[model samples]
Target: MDGVLVHEERAIPGAAEFIAALRRHERPFLVLTNNSIFTPRDLRARLHAAGLDIPQESIWTSALATAKFLSEQRPEGTAYVIGEAGLTTALHDVGYVMTTRDPEYVVLGETRTYSFEAITKAIQLIESGARFIATNPDPTGPSPSGSLPATGSVAALITKATGVEPYFVGKPNPLMMRTALNRIEAHSETTVMIGDRMDTDVLSGLEAGLRSILVLTGSTAPGQVERFPFRPTRVVDSIADVVPLVTELAEGDADGA
Candidate 1:
């Protein structure tokens, strides 16, 4: 969502039009983001502010995926979380109890301010037999000044201290894409994952048996595509280029119907 639709707070050129095309075509779509700092409602508002009229339910975050994974793995589980409202809210909705006393898991996620005390507590909890989970494997996140240390970086610190690596539930896992497809009741064969990064977005989509389109509006550059061992199904200059594809696909679907 960050790179594909909006870069920071500003909407990418034709992002709104692309979303409109999807809606016009009645496409099942969701804005997937590895950032667990904000809830879907929060993200929806952010998108609306950027002139994209995406619904709240159409936004999926790593926080939501982690919560779903935990609920499925162990219902009504307990966790010691070190994140903001997004992670906490998702867990709460999934009947997860948050605590510091011998919790079943130590969940890490994205937050602007990483508390040293909280990290210490998470490390101690994992040492005491609690499993470790993280929302995403992103080592750093974008900021106005520069890159800020994210969940993966903090998870590394805990792993070094406790010798227990966390199970990340976000992109590049392929499970992330599968679960997202499940959420929308969409088939992988028909789904197209349009994203800006080859490493996370494209790789996860490819692994999940979905076609991927890489856009250059974010982290990846045109020349950098060959550096990766794998490639996206297609590489476009930006989301603007995909608008016509959406129309073309929708027309084909109608014709087939």
Candidate 2:
């Protein structure tokens, strides 16, 4: 969502028009993000502020996917989480109990601040047999100044301390795309994954059996596409290039083609 629709909280060119076209055509799509720092409502507000009129239900985050996975794997389970309201609220909504004492899982997610005490506790918990889980595998996140240490970096520290590797539940992991597909009742055959990063987004989509489109608006440059052994179904300059495809798909659907 950050790169495809907006870059640094500013709407990318044609992003708003693309969303409008989708809505006008009655197309079902979700704005996906690996960031687990904010809830869907929070993301919706941010998108709206950037001039994109996306609903809360149309935004999906790694936090939501992690919570759903935990709830289904172990209903009413307990977790010791180190993250923001997004991760905590999702787990709570899924009837999860959060506690530091003997929790079933130690869930790690993205946050602006990383607490040393919390990291120590998480390591201890993992050492004590609590399973480890992380929202995303992004090692660093973007900031105005520079890149900041993200969940993956901390997860690596915890793993080194406890010899337990965390199971990540965000992009690059096909489970993330599959879970999103389940939420929208979308089929791999008909779904198209549009992303700015070939490593995570395109890889996930390709592994999930969906067509992938790579946009050069962020992360990936035109020259880098060929460096990857695999390629997206199509490579476009930006989201602007894909807007017409939305109209074409809508027309085809209308004609039962």
Candidate 3:
């Protein structure tokens, strides 16, 4: 329920009701987000503000997965970040030394205060043999007002300046999905990815061998699906429809029993 969960500061219509229904049924689900701006705690608070009473552990952000990956790859390296506080903090928590001058790795994510100077610094670092890493390659993110350019835009600028592509660590890349699934203890076959965007959310699920459900309430429109190469297993008008579908599936299984 990416876009259907929260559009900017406000929760989408029926989102809270749907989540309440999930809680009522004791069904397991998580808010798996590719946005790296918020930590789990921050996300939990935001959801609470939006009237979605979800636990912190149920909120997984790409920043957390990126930090986990970096910790395993390079335990102690200076990182030059071009992201929000959450991404920076996640890297620091994973034993990485955050630095701007002469860094070992150049990590890029979303930053509201982006500048050409910052992009230039990232390019110089990348050109100086520093490993370039990106949290996610999402080109745009949804807001209540409209869509805004996301981390991928920054990554593109850096790539254009440095002539090198950064390694992406978020959805459509499988690592983030694997981490979330591992944390939830859910098998690929039993899990379904519900999100608004087709390129990241749906494609990521398909790549991870899980079922994908696209909702029309986010970045993707119903008409665009027919032209897309990777089709989701199912499509719905909104996340509100998901609970009923699951109920139907459960009832069918009961009838079979």
Q: Write the per-residue lDDT of candidate 3 for residues 146-220, one digit (tens) a residue.
A: 778888988988888788999999988888998989888989987888888888888899999999889898888
Write model 2 residue lDDT over 1-257, tens digit each, in one string.
97899999999999999999998988899999999999999999999999999999999999999999999999999999999999999999999999999999999999999999999999999989999999998888877788899999999999998889999999989898998998899999999999999889999999999999999998888999999999999999989999999999989988999
Predicted structure 1: clash tally = 0
Global lDDT scores for all candidate models: 0.94, 0.94, 0.85
The TM-score of candidate 3 is 0.93
Q: How high is the lDDT of residue 213 in model 1? A: 97
Tens digit per residue, CA lDDT, model 1, 1-257? 98889998999998999999999989989899999999999999989999999998889899999999999999999999999999999999999999999999999999989999999999889989999999999988898898999999999999999999899999988888888898899999999999998889999999999999999999888999999999999999999999999999999988994
Give the residue spans of candidate 3 off by over 4 A.
250-257
Order the numbered candidates by lDDT, best leading.
2, 1, 3
Clash pairs for candidate 1? none
Q: Where is model 2 more than 4 Å wrong at Cα?
A: none
- The positional error of residue 104 in candidate 3, measured at the CA in angstroms, is 2.2
How high is the lDDT of residue 196 in model 2?
93
